[model samples]
Target: MVPSPALDTAARAVPRVRPAPAPESAPPPRRGRRAAVVLAPAGLTLALGLWGIRRQNSMWRDESTTYQVAHRSVADLWHLLGEADVAHGLYYLLMHGVFTLWDGGLLALRLPSTLAMAAAAAGVALLGHRLAGPRAGLAAGVVFALAPAVQRYAQEGRSYALVCAAVVWCTHLLLSAVTHPRKRTWAGYAAAASATCLLHEFAVLAVLAHGVALLSARLPEPLRWAWARAASAVAVVLAPLAIVSQQQASLVGWIDDPGRPELLGFAIPALVGLGCAMAPSAAAGPVPLRALALPLLILPGATLLAVSFIHPIYVDRYVLYSYAGFALLAGAGLEAALRAVPYPKAGAAALAAVAVAALLPYSIQLRTPQSRLDDPMAAARAVRELTRPGDGVLFMPARRREPILSSPGEFRGLRELALARHAVPSGTLHGIELPAPRIRARMLTVQRIAVVMDPPGRPLDDTPQERMKREVLDRSFRRCAEREVRGMVVVLYARPGAC
Candidate 1:
């Protein structure tokens, strides 16, 4: 109270203190909101996948193989893998477990694919969010769910969808590892990559993309070394499978060189993805996300396509995981466009409308019987309607037996003229074929024969047995009727007077 005048003057000169600015690194809002954004796309994918999961009343040729293989006992499956379809052995084993739990019907068979697709959708969203933002993630996930190709595989009973899911999550894990550079994160990445390759050996191509991403990131030396170690481990683990599958590569001998239209189909989407990744977007953070997305989207398909010129091993389904990268790029592009528009919400709505409009017709067509190469059930029914109890059924080329194999009940009374052993007994996707002499002899004994064949103009099977079948049918029988199913021809041949 009695302080000197000098002290009072000093107190008056003191500057006022300001409150501390909010911490720039305050913990992010509870992750629940972000999780919701990612989960929403997953939910959409699940709904779309499940909508017509069981609608395709019949299994196609490939699904028929799955059905035949999955229905076999574990011992038989193991034995079959040693002889054929080693590439698909793991998937067949998985389906065996699924069927064991619930032998409900096609629903049980296809549900796993549907669920895997949904998981892939969610992974795409999360990966997009990590690279770009929430909006981009959401858009990417929606785009993925609506993709006709993705939807097609999602409803099928096969391993392609699972491979896609594995690749998506593996990409996400790669992003995590690069950012954190932790042992646990890299381990997760390895596990994901391994699972992807195990689902389908072709998926090992994804690792090339991962390597590119790691190199482009320019991480610390320790992190880079860690990635190399992790990648090497994955390769070592996958080598055995790759070698075995290579021996059975003949299983894919049917895949032809892709034509101009097919190349265009693949190029268009990949170009779109690249364009999106290159586009300037503040929402898409500055780690050259394009470097990551581009390689994943383009490398696998391009490598396969190029190699196919030499080996004819290219098929779209084998590299379906590339779609995830495309979806991520598309989502980012759509979000960037929406942000640029005067009315962001309206722009987003319009974008979604355009996507739906573009996809609806194809989606509708996909649900019909004609969407697939052939409806096995339809072929079986057609054969049943045309044949008598004692008629002999012959699958020309032998592999054409898929339809009948899928609907064994329909042809119960008819003799399989050239079958030396049934698929399960023979431990083969189709079945063992009789010798040429045996086939001809069997054909001679039957008064009426029903032939299951490939469509006209398709290359005919020229095996000796097939040639003999043709010769005997032409010389001893008259063509009574012929019908064309979606992807096959059903011909009725009878003794000249009997017709």
Candidate 2:
């Protein structure tokens, strides 16, 4: 049908309607200032941590293991992959690449770990800021930097620091994404979480913690969906590593039980460490229960205690991530207590004073004898100086023995290998790996010397602690010279020319 002339004219002359402009939320002008404030704590913490690491002792046993494993030939390392510690394959490969560029000395070996710990402190600060505010971040960062446990691990060459860093950053990103439901934040959370898992398997605990945090906060459905999606992505990426990690699960069953007293002592010391780290001594000592929230302390303390009883899977290093939570709780508790007093600033000032007082003493303590980890290089030097051509070396237990004696880090199958390469013909013996009869017979025939890392003592029974101690030492030799070098105890010995 043909349109009417009037209708056609009306349509042609159509009304002019303007589309509405999209609404724009004003950008926060003080955002930059707030960001600086939020990050200030983390930055200062990182700086202090770096400084402490510079002044810290050299690499110890675990660090040594990292270097040796990393330095091994790819073929040899591949063979090792089928053995124990397939869980650490990626970390070993990464460290191996790192050691190739630099001599695996103390500084070179530990640089990566130092950086990792710094990153972890920053992540803790970010988490605090997101959970509370910039002030909370500041408190958390400073406390984290000064944290004796963090300093101890950061200064060493190990995977814990790296794993801790990943946990913190991933936690922060996950929380932010869940709180805001942004694709960028979700993406970041997924990536960080995956990296954390690669660095250490225990990092999966952060995911569990994140879930708890989200549920506690009652996050929105859309945000939860985003978080779940990010989590799924991380799980997918980590599947292969998970499969490989299964190969090392057998080690879990071997974890020695810390007796009741030992467990309690460990728990108390850990809590005290946190108190000393976060609160000023004045505050922690005079008014710890009040200054730090009782509920905050009680909840976690109970959880850890329960974990010890239920699963019995407790280690100082594994629960290291809990430090972040403790720091946050400490800051909040301090803030809450301060708010209760007549003058908020006075309470804060008093708490700050206490924090400084508490930390200074422990920081001094850390610089002293308590921080000593190991000494392999000096021991090696001593052995080398004493040994003549064709002299033989023997370790009573094999698992803790390595050729390179300078550092106390993990031997990574390198102790015997290195000694053989550098000091061969003058071979070494590890009783644990080699049959005791063969080792004894070999020692009887050769110009044999024994060096035990521990003090002079008889071998213990085949209990876990005794085994661990025995394996770590070289026995069946007498000390010729004992000296302390770089916080390590070195002993020299020599066997009869022909036994």
Candidate 3:
């Protein structure tokens, strides 16, 4: 049949159909670009983190302790672990392995911690991404990587940095598993949590914090059940270690409770510290309090107070996990605050200014060894200079018996300096040698006896040795020479015949 005009128009207008858009292609994620943007700041933070790796006070007493314990033979370390520090034996063992390749100087001893700080920075980034968004994660990582406290420990020869790194990673994995419970995520959580415990006993508190954060999310029963299983597995694995090191329980005895005022002081600054931590370089002004409010300001401070009331053990540094919390909160706050300002760029500039300003003092302090710690190397040098062949150096008061008598804790550097200088007979004086009569008699034969004192006071007089030295030895020998160096008094005594 002949087609009508309307039918003809309809046939001509008809078109072939095509497939619909394929799920919008997810807008290309922009993940790479976002990561690049975040990484720029993170890289700066990492640079700053490693900036003063060697510019610390000569290894302090605590650092010396780490070096001494870690450098022992494996068998020796095992034998001494229970007596010395069972709690940190694993850390010493790990560091011991690292020391085999390099001598245990400040740099070599602290290198692992520096690397651990870098890993922590990476964990911060991953955590920020997982907790908030990619931007938050980036900022958090940058903040953590550049934090003064983190940098401080990162450059020190201790286990705190490694513990910090493990905790950060464990938190990251923990939050991930909480958000999406699966076999793989649970496995990661277990591994990270296990490592955290191995790194430091205090890390258990951080696991508790993770539990709190997770419980806040209100996950379903299945996920919760799975998480419980994973956590239980970790506890099972770590219980034996904890039992073996039960002696560590005594270390907490010396801990004093922090009062409200002390808590407030620490809490307030910890928040500010977060801002300085996130910013690449700080400004020349104060850090904003807003940035420190969440994890930094309230959570850590409050948690510590709560822990103190319940467990009665609260030391500031022991809550190093609080540092990570501060970094995260600061990053989130800075990002949020910057977004709210009229000019994001200007806000960023202002924030950057404040961050740099705040960081300057800490940076300078970190770079100058004497600024952060006593000059142990100088003390060692002083000891070396005072020693002569066949001359015996005695630490006064007997109880002060150590390499320098004034500072025994810097044993690592002290011993190294002693070995390098070939100064033999560097033993500490016995308590018995301090008797006035004994000291005077010994000086008669030991003509070159040198006396070193701390805080500069006259010799003790209670002992018979002191009376004899004052009555008899004082006339026999003149006070030949004395000088003060690095907060110590060095007095040289020469016999009358020798003089």
Candidate 4:
């Protein structure tokens, strides 16, 4: 059959009607690839974070406090926060929920931090990708997951790792708002920033870094103004929490002036970050990335350290979020170095090998019980062995009560001679102490007493109650035995000649 000449001519003229090559769309597939690139690093981070997470079956003093506080009834937690640790109230609530689901010992206690650290690594990768490229992001995330300080906190059962994760995401959200100025984006920025601050009041310092990012950004006037508004909103939302945390500032009285070694330790990361920012590849990346990363790396810790000269509020873990910036900068530096080399892929593999080799010893150390200042579990075990039914336990200087609090079961049979109330009842980390006269009176009555004290050379706590406790013990009792436990001393005293 012969087709009509007009129809045949039209079909030939239509160029075979090839369906427009499927509209050249690959959005879904492209998105899926991007998600894989981001998530693979996150998964690696999670695996690394969970490694040796039990920390050799040891619990430090602070973790013990976390365990005790988180295990409390919700009503008791609320009451306790009113008197102390208002700074950690939200974290305690989160941990309480975690323990409620699975009270599976240290694993449950430390898992939240491990997960938070993994999230932080993912955010670091995303930030690096946004600033530079995917390779840089992956490298940064890997570096962060391997950092000694990061690994240390990842295994700790505390709010610092959570704060680090929140601040990293907040930085990412700030970048998003800068790039796409919309009400929803700005609101998301505000929420992320607020969450960071709420996680730990010290994390509010990260806002200064965000300000640096905004100021350096080449965004339009309206976007800049929107950022300012968002920053103000975050500040306004967190004001009450700041005020409450400040009221509890005395809790940090134990932080002494950072020594030379500590200062040098902090300087290493800051110097490395600054060097990366000043490197040639730093110019190749988005200008705002260097601006953002540099300030985030240096400002929080530097500001805290400078202020500590007058008020002494500096603690390394308090500014753990700064490490994220260090990771990003290190990633950029490595990429820059590799780009300059003759063979980039080989260069990258070599650099990574060097990093792992350098960090291996420290990584191994981080998993040991001696990694911490002292093992509260060890002290508690010693106390348990020394104690007898009806004997009294006395915490010298009051703060030494940490071991007892950590292993409450071990000390259950012994009376707490100076305790005014239990921690939950007294709304304190260590229960409130009885009056000096009462402490002395109780010490006199006990036929045998176990004393938990700090190692010698720790400046003596000269409070009236501590003085009274020493006076009574010296006058009425003779030392029967003294045992040195890691980070503590346990001494047994009995009525003269009773030993």
lDDT values, one for every candidate: 0.85, 0.58, 0.61, 0.84
Poorest 10 consecutive residues by lDDT, candidate 3: 415-424
**Per-residue lDDT of model 3, residues 386-499, tens digit only:** 545544344433322333532443332221101111111221112234445455555566565555545355446355544554455367666656655444555655677664
List where candidate 2 sits over 4 angstroms from the true fold.
Answer: 1-29, 52-57, 73-75, 182-187, 232-243, 249-254, 260-312, 339-350, 368-373, 385-389, 403-437, 456-499
Candidate 3: where is the Cα deviation over 4 Å? 1-29, 240-265, 269-313, 395-445, 448-499
Q: Write the per-residue lDDT of candidate 1 for residues 1-499, one digit (tens) a residue.
A: 6999998899999988999986776645647657876899899888888887766687788888888788889999988888788888889999999989888678988899999999999999888887887888888889898888999999998899999998888887877787777789999998878877888888888888878766776656777788788878888988988898788878888888889976997899988997888676544432456767788889899998999889888788889999988988888888888888899998888878888898888888887778898877778888998898999999888888887777788998998899898877677778898899999899899899999988888887789988999899989999998878889888999998886
Candidate 2: C-alpha lDDT: 0.58
List of clashing residue pairs for candidate 4: none
Better of 2 and 3 by TM-score: 3
Q: Tell me the spans in candidate 4 whose CA falls farther than 4 Å from its real position.
A: 1-33, 282-287
Compute each candidate's TM-score over C-alphas. 0.92, 0.71, 0.72, 0.93
The per-residue C-alpha lDDT of model 2 at residue 469 equals 29
Runs in model 1 deviating more than 4 A are: 1-30, 283-287
Reference-based TM-score, model 2: 0.71
State each candidate's clash count.
0, 23, 23, 0
Report the lDDT tens digits of candidate 2 across residue range 380-400. 555565555555554433433
RMSD of each: 5.0, 9.5, 8.4, 3.3
Model 3 residue 211 distance off true place after TM-score fit, in angstroms: 0.6
